[model samples]
Target chain A: MNYIFHFGDMWNARGEFVEGALMTLRLSGLAMVASLVIAILGALARTSGPKPLRMLVAAYVEIIRNTPFLVQIFIIFFGLPTVGLRLDANEGALIALILNGSAYTIEIVRAGIENISQGQIEGALALGLHRLQTFRLVVLPQALRIIVPPLGSQFILLMLNSSVCSAISADELTSAALDVQGRTFRAFEAFIVAAAIYFALSLLFSTAFATIERLAFGKRISR
Target chain B: MRSFNAGDVVYLLLAARWTVLLSLIAFAGGGLVGLIIALMRVAQARAARWFAIGFIRVFQGTPLLLQLFLVFFGGDLIGVPLGAWLSVILGLSLNAGAFLGEIWRGSIQAVPNGQIEAARALGLHYGQRMLRVVAPQALRTAIPPTVGFLVNLIKSTSLAAIIGFVELTRAGQQLNNATFRPFLIFGLVASVYFVMCWPLTIAASRLERRLALAYKR
Candidate 1:
């Protein structure tokens, strides 16, 4: 306990931390949107597609879920080049995040989708809606209600998982901390600041999601 | 560049034991801490309950990588000098404790309040009420999620590589560097992780279904 706390070096390097936090938000936000799209499609395939397609989606989910994100990113960032897919670090990171996030989100979205009673879809069809329209107009909205809360948790997890992208030299918060700590040798202070930023970022997301839930659910009730 | 040969595969397999060991250490340590956190979370004392909440908030709110970095360096700052093994163990355990604590808290709370009242009416003390009546039911529900979290813990031990611990992931990285076969090496590493984790995932789901049936009774 003899070491005096010196925030001096990390304090001077606050710009790196700020830029890094912004980069993290940017990277995760992009991945969040991209993965949601993928998950929605994958869940559709899982729940309503042909037998072969369902098996394929199920296998993808199982493989991804059972493996580590770090290894998955390593495979994408490092492994793909052998197949002539030479993506830069950020592109690879985004791809990796989307792939990883969708596997989990597909399950979450699938759970939401399956929770809607079949009679509702039938009722929509009975009202002269097309099958596609029935899904979009009737099923999806109700499924979304059950889906939003878990989706929020998944997005928060995706944001935190973005820290792993730094291993591949992706320009995010953890890498930002790595740069400052490597130079300042203030590993303790450097990571503390990075972790606090992450903490704040997650808290912000949680609060925003809670507000969205309130508004969305309230609208349904009032209408 | 060397090819990813049998020796590299053997090396990776050997290194996987460290990953398993690290995971076990974290699980054991985290389990003990999680039990305490779960108890405190459900405790009547405001300070204990708040402490548990804040512990979960801080630990779960941040990424495990940063928490690893903190222990990996916070030790250096405090003159404790916990090197890679000690640091990864402590860091992963703390993070796992927060998650497992939350899971087990839900399980504990799932037990009916009337059951506790019934125990109290029967002149059962707090210890008797918890150990004899509540624990049996909570344990039935807790097993599935607890097993599920172990899969996550197993995958998470790969983070030890960042701290220079030569677990399976680091082994793969080193072999990939030597062989220039990232595809072969990391794929093998991931498959090894899959082999370890997939069975647990299956078991967890099975247990979950069985628990559901038990509750249905």
Candidate 2:
């Protein structure tokens, strides 16, 4: 092998790389919150709403879960404008991430909710608490504990997935690498840098999640 | 631009064959590499265990797309010169290896200690014990998740499009470019994927449920 390594060019592109990483973080963070909200509602409806609503949530989860995110990106970014709705690439990427993330999170949150026994909800009701109050007070805390570990991993997957947004030319770490690689023709060094940043970010997030899991839910075993 | 037509649908379906072919190659390669990594993760030697752990960490911690990018371009830069086909196969296999290794390791560990101890007491070697006893049991647990990962693998092959592999999604992209029917083309691409994946998803769940029932019995 006669390939000479040139990471010097990569080092020179640090600003763009940092900006891209921050873009990834921003894209993922916003998607996480938005999807969590949607998942919570979706899960609630799936668990206890009308049959049609439950079926709608079920279909949503199944369809989104089955399709590739890349296709979803094309549909949103390119297809929507054809239907008289238009969103810029970043907006479309964010929406796609939110939609995709919610399907899985809805399932996760639903499973967590299901883990709460019927008796507890009954007990909360028998205590004369309102239904919403019963949910917020009696159900949510325990459900959150059950859901955190999976939610953490799912969020990380979502973050990793936002890398796909680069396909639509949204400003993210992977795209930053692509831009530099295009300019410098240093594909290997550029991708390695991006991949390393991703690795570090993943480790950082997983470690943080593990700590949160331990501190917040380790001692309490809800019966 | 030519209008979207049945011929385009046929073209898209034909391209799906590459997606399936790539997935199968990765599945086979991943299974082989994964088996070795799983064994290493469960091995008695510290170095073997650590190597397996590090392999899993690197592969799993990074996005699969970046792995594909690295292998696709990194190979050329390093002078190995793997083209898109071989690079995607190698990259997906390695990534799948890490995930499947982790899955199978859990399955291997879940084997009762008494079973392994008895195999040892019977004077069976590591290969004999793992092959004859541990693997049979582990295979049972591994099958559902293995199938589950295959669905993930199939969906992931779409990322090969970004690297310019003309699989199902890439074909959809090409059709969309020509026909300007992103909704029809990409939606059709998604449906093709959904059809390919949903059955496996169902089968995986069914297998999981069956396994759970077996445990109860």
Candidate 3:
């Protein structure tokens, strides 16, 4: 077991890894924001809409929740290319993450929405507010408050799950580590660095989400 | 060109055996380790509690894929070289243990404080109370979520493909590469996972419902 330690390679390739980390952060941030918006709409559609819309949302949640994220990635990346719908690896990964995140988000958001008392909606309607406006001004605010802690955790999970993009050679942190591992034949060192970087990124993302939460709902909750 | 054949299906099913085996190993190994973690988390010592928290935070906070990478390659980098099978088991078990521990700790703490006080007043020691009183109740409460986590642990084993473990996902990757039938191959892969997970999901839900009913009564 002649082990040669070289911390220098990782330092030498720091720029590439930093670039990859930034890309991962960017992709995850955008996907999280997009999925949250979509989930808010989907949750509403599922709970209060027509039967057909409810069925559609239910099917969406069930299918995605039951399947593996890797298979979903393969469908978008490899399956789409055969139909002349090629996307680069990053785009494919982002699309997959966004789609996957939306289903779980819908479920979480729906839980929060259900926590809102039914009387609140009726009261808003009685006050002359329209259905959409009542949902916007009354239901969603309360739901979002109940859902914030879980929502923060979900965002953290998304940030971490973004590491899966390495499968498609998405030059993200894990892929960068793999590239360096291949070049240096230092698989252990490369992976340790990659794992630490991922942990650090997760911590950073959660802190940022907490800050955003304070800004977004701090006033409402206090008042 | 080899058309969609029965042989391919047989091969894929054969590969699924490893997936099932890996899941069992992970669950069995993780369950034991998780119990220890759970107990330690509820231990009176401050250091033990903090250590459990740190373990959960580190493992739960990072991607399983990265941990798999560390386990797979970290073994190679160090003197102790291991096969992918061993590394995958070790890595998945560690991650599963941390999460299961946290979940079980929540259940343990959820038990009424009065119950513990009653046990203590009856001259039962800490170990006696935990073994005879606290754990039995927590076990019933923890079953459903524990089962749910087991299902998730199984699905997550697919991430082992990145390290070339040749489980279901890797087998699907190999078939897809050869047949250029990503749609069929990966679709099959997902269906297999769905079949594997759906039963556990249903059972967990039923278990939770039963537990809720029992509590109400």
Candidate 4:
């Protein structure tokens, strides 16, 4: 109860904290883009691809969804090196994040795709659009609208989940906070600062996503 | 220099007991606290609602890893030093409570207003109305998401390892370090988690379908 708060110690380590924050942003950004691509493909495959491909995607989603991301990170960071696919800690962390993020994203995107009315696809076909063109022009646009909100939340969750990457020495925000705590012996201050930074980052990302949602879909809605 | 053996698998399984224990503590503690939070979120008092909102925002917005770190380490900075077991349990419970409260709040709200009015017209008080009418309906909607969160909570108990709890993930790390066989060790680790969680996932979906059937015309 008598402990004095030491914001000064954390302030002095601002550079390290900022660098760590950027690393977090970088990791989540890369994972977000990669997962979105993979999710689109996975959703497509699950929805209309050959039977085995759909089953494969289903298995991937189930396994990833059921397991903890901490174990997934360890499996990628430690287990992959044994298979002659060695990657450094950051690379391993990024790949783990992508794999984990994509599974959830695939489910969200698949739900969105399935929610699209069958009539729309039929209409596109009747208009002489090929299957690919129908999917691209008719199905995808409507699906993206349904998918955006959940996708935004998923991306933010990915950003928060990236904290676990520090388990494998990824040098992100949580790791940087630990390093500062180790060096300064100000565990409370170091973590408080890190938590605040994470809070700010989440708010920033959510606001940016809101803006993107508005700009991308604002015109179509009658609100 | 050593290879993974049956003994290592046994060691990992033994350590899994801590994971199960930690998860149960989190779920029980979180359920108790989360019910309070969910009620507070729906409470008529503005202060109670705001308190619930702020609690949910802080807990949900930050990483569980950071929360674990803060509780374990911050305990020492003050006069109270929490052991790893207590800290991990406290941390996960707080985090899980926030999420469960949010989920339950949504379910409670999803219960139709007509039901509430009907209960009021029957001369039921707030507590009676909630316990007898509202909660029963909300329970149906809440089961699937609650189970989903519980599954996530069980998996997240692995984070207890970071604070030196020697749970399942940490046990895997120690074994892998000794055996230097990452594939077998970590793959075994993942399968253990899958075995623990996959059944709950199936149960949640089945419950959702059952609830849907009850409402079908």
For candidate 4, lDDT tens digit of each residue in A160-216? 999999999998999999999899999988988999999988888878878888899
The C-alpha RMSD in Å for every predicted model, in order, reads 2.1, 1.7, 2.5, 2.0
In angstroms, how far off is B4's CA in candidate 1?
1.9
- Cα lDDT tens digits, model 2, A52-88, are 9999999999999999999989999998899898798
Better of 1 and 3 by TM-score: 1
> Which runs of model 2 end up more than 4 angstroms from their true locations?
A219-223
Candidates by DockQ, descending order:
1, 2, 4, 3
- Residue B88, candidate 4: Cα error in Å is 0.6
Off by over 4 Å in 1: A219-223
TM per candidate, chain B: 0.97, 0.98, 0.94, 0.96
Model 3 per-residue lDDT at A58? 90
Q: What C-alpha lDDT do the candidate models reach, one value each?
A: 0.92, 0.93, 0.87, 0.91
Report the Cα lDDT for residue B84, model 3: 84
Error of 1 at B45 (Å): 0.8
**Residue B40 error for model 3, in Å?**
1.4
- B1-217 per-residue lDDT for model 1 (tens digits): 7676788788999999999999999999999899999999999999999999999999989999999999989888878889999999999999999999999999899999999999999999989998999899999889999999999999999999988999999999998888888877888999999999999999999999998897799
Q: Please give the ranking of all candidate structures by TM-score, highest first, separated by commas.
A: 2, 1, 4, 3
Instruction: Return the candidate ranking by lDDT, descending.
Output: 2, 1, 4, 3
Where in model 4 is the C-alpha error above 4 Å? A219-223
